[model samples]
Target: MSLFDKFEPLNAQYVRLEAIDANPFAITFDHVLSPTEAMIGDSRILLLGTNNYLGLTYDTEIVTKAVQATRAFGTGTTGSRIANGSYDGHKKLERALKDFYGRKHAMVFSTGYQANLGIISTLAGKNDHLLLDADSHASIYDGSRLGHAQVTRFRHNDPNDLHKRLRRLADVPGDKIVVVEGIYSMLGDTAPLREFAEVKREWGAYLIVDEAHSLGVLGETGRGLAEMQNVEPDVDFVVGTFSKSLGSVGGFCVSNLDDFDILRVACRPYMFTASLPPGVIAATMEALHQLRARPELRLRLIENARRLYAGLTGLGFCLGPEPSPVVSAIMPNPETAFALWSDLLKAGLYTNVSLPPATPNGLALLRSSVSAAHTPQQIDHAIALFEQTGRALGMVPASAATHASHHAAASPSLSVTSA
Candidate 1:
């Protein structure tokens, strides 16, 4: 048997998607005009699926810093951080992260995925225990497998289930590390951090919160769910990414543990991977400054999310339980989800099409992440497009489409019937 045989199923799926020109995975924007808009083969597309929550990708200050750094430090850092890759920008960014989180130590990685991989895998040793949410990100699961720790998954967002699992390990001797995300990527649902924190404390387990999606989107100071829930003090580690609200590429872990710096030497993912370039580091630092300086961005982001969530809900689309930056509409099946995503793209509204395996509970999703940069008119236009497409596909009701059309009337520049 060939090693490629295992990919036959995926190849079949791609073939089916390509037959109708509905391959969501192959989409490439010809030009990104702004955080809320882009061009795909000359078609003006409203970007609804990007995780640019604060929408600072085009900020002049951030961009300027990035350009300046690139000019000063060249294109790339060719070596790993443990070797010759560590630069001043790297250290400054780590210090900025530590200061922002009020933590004692901060470790940066080349990518957000590596941040979880480095931290989770390194901390949980052969004899340790790794207890994570059942729907934890792939990075977390990979990290669990990378280490010798015995991995156990509790129910997603169910603190009671976590407690039960931890109790069974109570008699065990290994250290327990409980990992959870601030905001689940699929459904946009938030973890009850406070409840999980209580469980961690009750069981004397260390808690790690991956705020990859929630950073600069939650908390008064944009510290994430832990800060919003007033459970920051109880959390043992906070891991996040600069690619989201920060609008760059990198990952970090911040903690108050006195010996947290030791991970720099022990984490294989951190030690072996090349450090982020000067531009990314500079832009991320500037973005952090902007995130703290502009709390209004956070307010506008939540307001926009609520608008989209309400609009979709009014159209009879099932959505996440609460309103957050990430808003997703549940689909009945893969075919329907694929159709909706393709139709949405053709209608100049781009969204994410999430299928089983990556998504929780084997469900399909038409995911849309709102940005503060999106104007109310743009939001209305997006809703109008969804209504038109959903109605055409017979997924949304005719009456609901008629009712939703009134909201689109004010968006004079955008046409609801683009298709």
Candidate 2:
């Protein structure tokens, strides 16, 4: 009888999670010291759940650029891009992104979610087809709903399934757009981009690669999975966000399509939403330059990821497919996952706890992401903490805990705590 009645099920679930000290939907960091450290509720916690892959958030040069831009252009762009929000800095940033991706056209949106929504909804129209990975992000799914396309979902990372679906639409008269991500956010697993590209070509479908998690962490030049897989030429569009590696807020879609500029008026999300602030645009441009100049950051990030992954696996924890910027430890169930997550937080480590329905195949996850700014010592400290907490919670065996303790004791600077 009330408007709030629809949320009864979700409210019950939230209360249950809260009772167990596992509710992670709302958390706040009182102080962010750097990309890898933050203070939360009187505890100085190691930040492992942030997507700051390249760790440029605290870079002095980038900060200076942002400050200068804010002083010059004021705080915000109050109007949508279609109206008074179009500024010279926004245009300049678009030009920079265009050159960075080697694309003929680039359009900027207020946020990464908007970029996916705008691009997907505009590209696939009535009677058209929108094929997406089953494990795609929520933005991709919502974008499909906003459009009039008949959506199809294929198995995640299974190129054969994608090909089969495309083959089924052979007789269809409308255009087809296949959407995938460079790196899946939940599992941190990469797509078979080469195979996907091949299937798109065979089916004559447009391909869109969302590289939000892969940018600045893949390829020699950091163009993401498409560049690493050598399939850049096959991809019709590349969507990415500045909030991740760039340490700023914004989104963009770049393409070489001749009529790409027409989306300025056709894409509802882009045209209706206000553009990114001038300060963010300026800072993102600087961050891009920094990412390009320092290829070593990517190397450091992967090395940290591998070290952390190996440490967790050695301690008898299940992990993702491979070492990546994001490392997730799977738990036996939601309860166990929540317990471990709470234990980790109490041990001065902040990680992301992903529950069922949000995770793949209903598996819960304690997700941790590595950043280039994380020192070797910090990574080892985090490993020792995980070992202590995991062992206390019965997630790790006694023998493995003893082994980890012995290893920790051998290093004078490393100490394992029971907290």
Candidate 3:
């Protein structure tokens, strides 16, 4: 057989998507205008699929810091941190993260995926057990497989199921590490962290929470769900990314464990990969400072999310369980979801088309995330476009359109003073 024959099934699926003009996987942005808008080819489209929750991608301060760092440290590290990639800026960023999370130690990785891979694989080794949420991110699953531990998955957000699984392992002589996310990326639903923490405590298992989507979008101080749910003490490790709220590229793990520093040498992913560029580290630090100094950004983000959620629900689109920065609409099927996504793109709106394996429970999703930089008019315009597209696609009725328009008209002002 040919070397590429194994990808025949994937090729067939790609052709099917292209035939329907719904091949979102091949789409690309030519230029980014702002945090909430971008140019795809020659058309300017409103960006709704980005995870830039606080919308600091184009912030003046962040850009300035990045530029300064580039001039100071040259371009790339050109080597792994274990060799020559560890610089003053990298060490400084780790220290800042350690202070930010109030943890005893912090280790930064080149990418968010590596942070998960390095931490999870190193923590649960040969004789250990890893209990993961069924809806956990792909990185978590890959990390579990990289290690020699036996992995068990509990139902998504089901604390009772987690308890039962941990109980079954009561007789097993090994360390148990329970992994969960602060906010699920697909459905925008948050995990019952308080309950999960309780269960982990009762079962004597260490808890690791991935706050990739919740950081800068939850908690009074923007710590994460653990802080929002008041269970920080129950959590043993916190894994997060600078790519999301921080508007940069990197990942980190913070823990109060006394020997957490050992991971610097033990984690293969971290030791083998080159570190982040100096510019990225600088920009991420600045963004973190901005996130802490400006709490109103989080408020504005939630307000925008609530507005969009209300508008879409009023137009009869099935949405996630609640209003969050990450909002997704479930479609009847993959074809319908693809058609809707293509329609939205044609209407100058850009969103994510998530299909099975990537989405939860085989559900197709038209995912749109709200950014703090999204203006009120931009959000309202997006709602109007969704209504028009939904009606044209028979996803929403004409009667629902009237109600949606009325709801949008009667909506309160979205003005919130920045700090």
Candidate 4:
């Protein structure tokens, strides 16, 4: 059989997507105008797809820090920290993370995915067991495969199911680690962390909360869902990426566990991957400072999210359970979802289209992440656009268009801040 045979189904899907000029995966932004807007082809569109939760990507201070660091340390670190040598900035960033999380130790990885790969694979030894939420991110599942641990998946966000799964392995001779996310990316629903923590404690299992989407978007000071749920102590490790709220590149793992530094030598992904550029580290450090200092950003983000979520709901569309920065509208099917996505793009609105295996239960999603940078006017405009597109495509009732009319009319003209 040909090596390419396995991808025939995927190729067929791509062909279908191409037929309607709705290849969401192939979108290219010609120019990014700001955290809230970008140019696609010749048309400028509201940027609802990018996960810039706090919208610090275009902050002058962060950008200045990055530029200064690039000038001082050169463009990139040519080798891995283990091989070449650790930069002072790397250590400083790790220390900042430890202080931010109030943890005893922290380790930085070249990428967020690597952080999961290194930590999960390294911590779960051959004799260990990993109990993961069934809807855990692909990185978590991939990490399990890279290690020798016996893996089990419980029902998504169901603590009782997790408890039952752990009970089944009560007698299993190995360390137990429960892995989950603070905020799931697709649907934007948060895990019941307090309940999960209780389950973990009852079973004497370690807990890892991946806050990739929740960082800088949740909690009183943005320590993520563990802090918001008041279960920080129960979470043995907090893994996150700077790519999201921080608007930089890299991943980090913070923990109170003893001898955590040993992972520097134990994790092959950590050892093999090149270290992040000095500029990225500096930019991320500045972003972290901003995230902690500016709680208003979080407030604005949630407010924007509520507006969009409510607006979409008013338009007679099914959406995620709660109002979150990642506002996802459930589509009836992939075809309708693809058509809506294309129409939205053509109408100067850009949103993420999640389909098939990437989405939970093979569902189709028109996902849009609200940003602190988005003005109320922009949010209302997006709603109006969705109303128009949905109605035109029969995805929403014709009468649904009236729901957004008042808000759209009251919304002032769109004005995007220059990045």
Candidate 5:
């Protein structure tokens, strides 16, 4: 049998996925929304699958700056930053981030994945060891692998497990990097940052917190989980992506270590990859300014999350621990999750379908991400649709193993929908 034939099976299998639609699933002028909201494909559909936590995607000021910078600097950087791609704007943004996060130094990367790749792989050589949460993002795991380091996965969100791994690694030498997410992408759960910080201190290990989804969503100033828990000082390094809350596409690494600047010279990924485009850097800088200046945005985001959580629960949908922007309605398998996602789309709603490998143990998830820009009406409508489609799938039927619990909106909490 041909190797290419193996790839064809994937196509044949998923092609008949239920409720699959052909049209692009983005929004247009038909929807009453800010410029950023216009980016969604399903215009009339309720937006419950976006990571625009603070919903700063369409601030006119940020857009205008992006336009002006693009006009002046052109579209592409045309060269790697290590070569001739570094512009005054790039340096300015880097300095601005250092000041914003109150860190000694910060380096900007083309994308968030690259940030982890460049940082982790550079810090952890072949001789070092990497201790990571089982629930870490794929980027973190891949970067650890690329480093050629000895990788060990600890239990998800379990500090005790991390402690055990650290104790074992204490016998090893060179560097030990402990990696965890600020807010897990699949389960939407947060790490016990303070507890992990203590373990890192006792074990003499370096800590790296990836704040991809948490930045601009957590903390009063929206710095992320470390900032929210007042454990910023304890974390040796902080990595974040601009794609989610910042309403832009970029990544950054901040550290107190001076040698990190040398990563520009030493890191192969950083040296090889082209720098972020001028327009993006411009928009990103503007987004950072807004993130720091507008704490009210974070408040509005939290309120929206609370309201969405309550509504989802009232409609008998399970949610994540605490009121996170990313809430999931988990199903037993991939087929079930895909069907629910399709139904939600048909019901004028949009969300993500998360399945195995991405989510552990083959658990399929109809993940909903609440945005600050989402109105109460939108959330309520989404809840009703979720309840309606979920029931049709026997999700709430008495015979289903996961149908034991009932969700009520009267409580001030998020109920996770799971099997």
Candidate 6:
């Protein structure tokens, strides 16, 4: 049989799973939860790995708006945006985004992934060059390939590398799009926007910033990294999603381009895909408003992240820098990481497990997402669980080496100040 025809292991660590079944933390849940908790199969697990950065999923107002919209518009769109699905709901949501991002216009997509795919693939076509950060989202990679653009990769967050790459493209320019993210999804570090602004100034190429993880989590007004860095005016395009902080399931692109209107008709993904449903539209509008008006949500989220991050490090766990909404605990290898994952589940805490290929440099990760909804008590519980798991797995000794930052912690707590 061909390699493609062969069935692969669902989990490589199945042999050790006898331990999993015996775990007190192996769980199932069946109810709604706050920022730091979830009901899985039947157990209430602390949500240390949710992308619900703002905890807007459980907002009563958003739920009410979604329900109202469903009553008015029924269920699905039933057709693609180009055919018979373009509703007022789409335009309304787009307008709300435009005002929120301080842009003249915005275009919506089915998902953040598609937003990148449609915009990147459609704008930078054949004969173009795409200069992107190596750690950019997969959607960006796919879009660049689909665009058939000549791709050049710069080291993660390394502006000097970007400058060198741009220098090479100086002579040959059909069009070049410098792509980056407001916040990297994996390690949750932010891009150096000012350095990028300087590079683009010299290269004279357009810049696209993906704020899928940054929107509503950074910036004074929830406009994302561009706003936080005061580079919104410098960026050529800003793409983001309703999935993460937006508490919904749509995506958007905001640009000052008169060409943006053109992409609606020219872009195959936007044209062929069914438009967003009314409930998504209505709920998103509510979410965006809350994201802007309620800066407290952002502040609480940062505080929670800092607190959780710090607690993990203090416990001798190797973690990412500063408190980002995405806090990853990297393991030396996939086997060790999987072992840690199984152990964590046994302790009743669930997180994203990063293995090779998915994680660069053969590094595996136990990724946790901090949410504003996590109370001090919930965070403390999760940290205790981590320590327990680490000790049990031999990843750490009973007392550990005490050499690993004996007092490590997430960043300090945060508070959002309104404009």
Clash numbers, per candidate: 0, 0, 0, 0, 13, 13
- Residue by residue across 188-207, what tens digits does model 1's lDDT show? 88888889999999999999
lDDT of 5 by residue, 1-419 (tens): 87778688656655655235522222233553651233334446566777788777788998899999999999989989888759888899999899988998899998999999888888988898999999888889889878888899999889999999889877777788899898888767878899999999999899999999888877757778888778998888999998999888989999887677888898777889899898899999999998888877776676667766666665555666666888886677777777788777777777888777789656778788887777766666676677778778777543432311322333332222110
lDDT of 6 by residue, 14-41 (tens): 4355454522224345665775676766
Listing every candidate in turn, what is its Cα RMSD in Å to the true structure after a full C-alpha superposition? 5.3, 5.4, 3.0, 4.5, 4.6, 3.5
Tens-digit lDDT string for candidate 3 (1-419): 99989999989989999898778999889999999999988899999999999999999999999999999998889989887748999889989988888888999998899899889999998999999999999999999999989999999999999999999999999999999998899988888888999899998999999999988988878888888888998999999999999999989999999988988889999999889999999999999999989998998898888878888888889988877887899999988989999999999999998888988889999999999999878888898899899999999988775433534432222212211
lDDT of 4: 0.89
**lDDT of each structure?**
0.89, 0.87, 0.89, 0.89, 0.78, 0.80
Structural similarity to truth (TM-score) of each candidate: 0.95, 0.95, 0.96, 0.95, 0.89, 0.91
Q: Model 2 off-target regions past 4 Å?
A: 401-419
Q: What's the lDDT for candidate 5?
A: 0.78
Candidate 1, overall lDDT? 0.89
**Superposed Cα RMSD, model 1:** 5.3
How many pairs of residues collide in model 4? 0
Task: Record all residue pairs in model 4 with backbone atoms less than 3 Å apart, i.e. clashing.
Answer: none
The candidate 1 region of ten consecutive residues with least summed lDDT is 410-419
Q: Residue 177: error of model 6 in Å?
A: 0.6
lDDT for each residue of candidate 2 in 205-316, tens digit (9 for 90 to 100): 9999999998888875888988888899999999999999999998999999999999999999998877888889889999999998998888788778877877887788
Q: Model 1 — TM-score against the truth? A: 0.95
TM-score of candidate 2 relative to the true fold? 0.95
